[model samples]
Target: MIVIQAKLIFLNQQDKQIVLDLMRRWSSCMKFAYKRLLEGYDRKTLKRDLQGTFDLNSRYVDDAIMKARGVLESSRQLDNNPKKVIFGGRDLFGKLQKRHINGKEYQKLKTKWQERRKGNLYSRGDKSKKGNLNTRIEVKENGTFLRINVGERKYVYARIEAGYKKNKRREELLQEIAESNIPYSVELKLKNGNIYAYFAIEEEYPEIKITKEKGVIGIDINAHPGNISWTEVDEKGNLISYGNIPMPELASGSKDKKEYFRWQYAHEIVKIAKEKGKAIVIEKLDIKEKGKRGDFSGRKSRRIRHSFSYKSLLSKIKTLAKREGIEVIEVNPSYTSIIGMLKYAPQYMITKDVAAAYVIARRGLGLQEKIPDNYIKFLNALTVDELEELREHVKKTVRNKHIKKKHLREINKAMEFLQSLESKPGRVLEPLDGTSFSAYDFWRVLKVAVVTPLSPEKVKRDFSVLKELLIQGKWGGP
Candidate 1:
């Protein structure tokens, strides 16, 4: 969907007052509906009550309920308390309660808070109603104007001045809305003592032109180094090119600035795909809030978690690709990094992140990776006693460090994989005739025997150092 913002020009004071009154009533009904929804009130009963309790019509009441429910559901998704949600903003409310300012500053803040709390009105689209029922935009010979139905045959009109120069997409959408009766939603909002109208219309994406038939470009977003590493792989799963886009500014910037940078980087990525005539492949990541307060995650860990905007960047890339007619493929992220570290990083002579991107690209093309022969040999050479010794050494190492509980649990699982190897060394060391050890077993044992001995800093940054140990069987420092 595309949203167009237009400034509302009131022709007369009467029309402005009517709109203001409607907005105030709409916001009140919205707050009331939110409370009812929290109390387990269903939509049918809540809509009836809202219409009777406020001066809004049935349609407006329904819209109010939808808006309230949207806010409630969003808060719940973020694991926030519904009762503690401030309508305007928690920061402004806190300032007012604390009386942090006086005179003009305080009054200015108070007015802004009131506008945010009580100046929202919305109407859903209706194809039969000419885009919207209560709020409709009409195109006449003179100019474009918005017609608002204010109950009892009363109406208020405002001139719409959408800047076509700044947003070409909005201009095209506006032209479409004027030419055809395409369903479009409108939201009237008051910002900085001025009323603005936001129009949301469905966007028809073009057919995909670039696909994975040629190759795929895989992207890996790294938080510590603050860069996006991407690798282009041919159809035969050979690396054609690789590059990195540094985004150090994303970690510390205004929200708008950060969003602008994300869009810019997304455009860059899509441009590369278009040039190469290949589809983009990215990891399907579902990152939840982590490193909560008092979790023993240090300042650095917290910073990395907070600074990572993988979802935001990936979303922007997908949205832009859709508009540009570029096919985007999402692959499972499981073991991509580990597989890269142990296998591709050493073989390809590339950084771990780039190797991970290569793995993702190959996976997108239906390519399956097998354990390298050297890695298989390295694993098979370990005897049962050596496996037991490595497990004990890893346990002691973890016990000596300040590892998080989750990391400790992961180490314990890796140890279990080691114990399994010790218990049935014959089976695990058997020839790869369909009954040998799986790739997962090798990765887990490697984590315990090989990766666990390295320093935490080295493990996080680079894995190319493991090339010596894997190729020459050189035992590195513990």
Candidate 2:
């Protein structure tokens, strides 16, 4: 089922008071419990570090008062020292952000409480000193919120209140979340200006089919402004078109590459739909939930992630493809990159303004040395084999802006190395440099050794010929 989850962020003052109040109450309760525990204290009967256990009682509000205490005592012994306790320690849930959490905040608090602690009820710093106590804490639904002080350099949780914008923005933050992949979607819109955005999710369903003949789409992931993967399916769903856009540059990932990848991919879907009535097969994705990552990295990452409309483009593709009578199916696109496009021809987009750089490189494109690989894939003076491969993948993925310098340097090295064609009768020496260089042109160009640093692959085929003839003797290093 298609589902969407949104997070709204806001900041205000009223919420801060609620946080401090709860802390104060929690601290008093802990002090009372400590007095009782001391009365019942028996070195053998006493759980352990008496002080740490009491502090843990209030912090782990949701924990079994008994379980929390037991854990605290055990934890105390682990450190073999008593931690300092604080009364409602420093300010954590400042009045600024009131609504910065989700439905699962309470559970999160309980879980965090069980971890090692250095301070009192609130996750704090020194053994005795109160930490900002940045552990998670569950808040009451009557607008109660929980937050931490960013850098007091401690572990703690302070319960507060969820305010207007802060409350709306709670779900907006997330960290490294799960994956979400869809066939064709509307790409997210980005504003160079304001944080505001406006768009309704566009949804549709199309007939899906399974192809008997599976195809493979090779992908060239690039780290540029955006990403583009190559994709194509034959008459029988056998991926055909052997090219696509390079990976895109993401502040944190490969978005541009994916954008162009889908754009070019959709064109193919439309084309195929018009030809043979077939369904487009892709992975079903849920951008919302997958981006939630159980609340890591805070809400900012999630908010910004939603900003890129990868789905928007997909929606358009579906519309156009459906009009052409094409069916769409979703296969798991998870790990498609590492899998080397097992059943699909991944597409990478070149310039919308011009053909991909590889196309130019194949034809012996010339350029100044300073240009990045976005401009040149093959060194202007590369050997024929290298040039051919460059046209397909390497050239596009690499950012050899220093074309003149890097290009000539690579060529000279190759030439000198290729000339040292020597093989000893008893043993063979592998070309150190070429072993791990871009042989997207030459499959398995890496001796399998240079390619994998930890676990090296043995040559299943003859290699002395290749090793001695080229890439050895300081051509360069892996």
RMSD of each: 16.0, 21.4
Pick the TM-score winner.
Answer: 1
Instruction: Note the residue pairs that clash in candidate 1.
Output: none
Cα error, residue 403 of model 1, in Å, equals: 3.8
C-alpha lDDT score of every prediction, in listed order: 0.77, 0.32
lDDT of 1 at 474: 70
lDDT of 1 by residue, 1-478 (tens): 7788988998998899899999999999999999989999999998887787898899899999999999999999999999989999999989988755999989988999999999999999887775777888775434567889887688898887776456534533464464446688889999987899999989567899889988999988777678888999998889999989998767776543565576667778888988998999998865543434656364434544577567768877887788778899999877788888777787678888888889899999999888766666777665556655655555565554545343455556655555566566364643233444455666766665566556522464467777877677676354
Worst lDDT window (10 residues) for model 2? 172-181
User: Model 1: how far is 356 from its true place, Å?
Assistant: 1.2
Please report, as a residue range, the 10-residue window in candidate 1 with the lowest summed lDDT.
429-438
Error of 2 at 213 (Å): 18
Instruction: Please give the TM-score that candidate 2 achieves against the real structure.
Output: 0.27
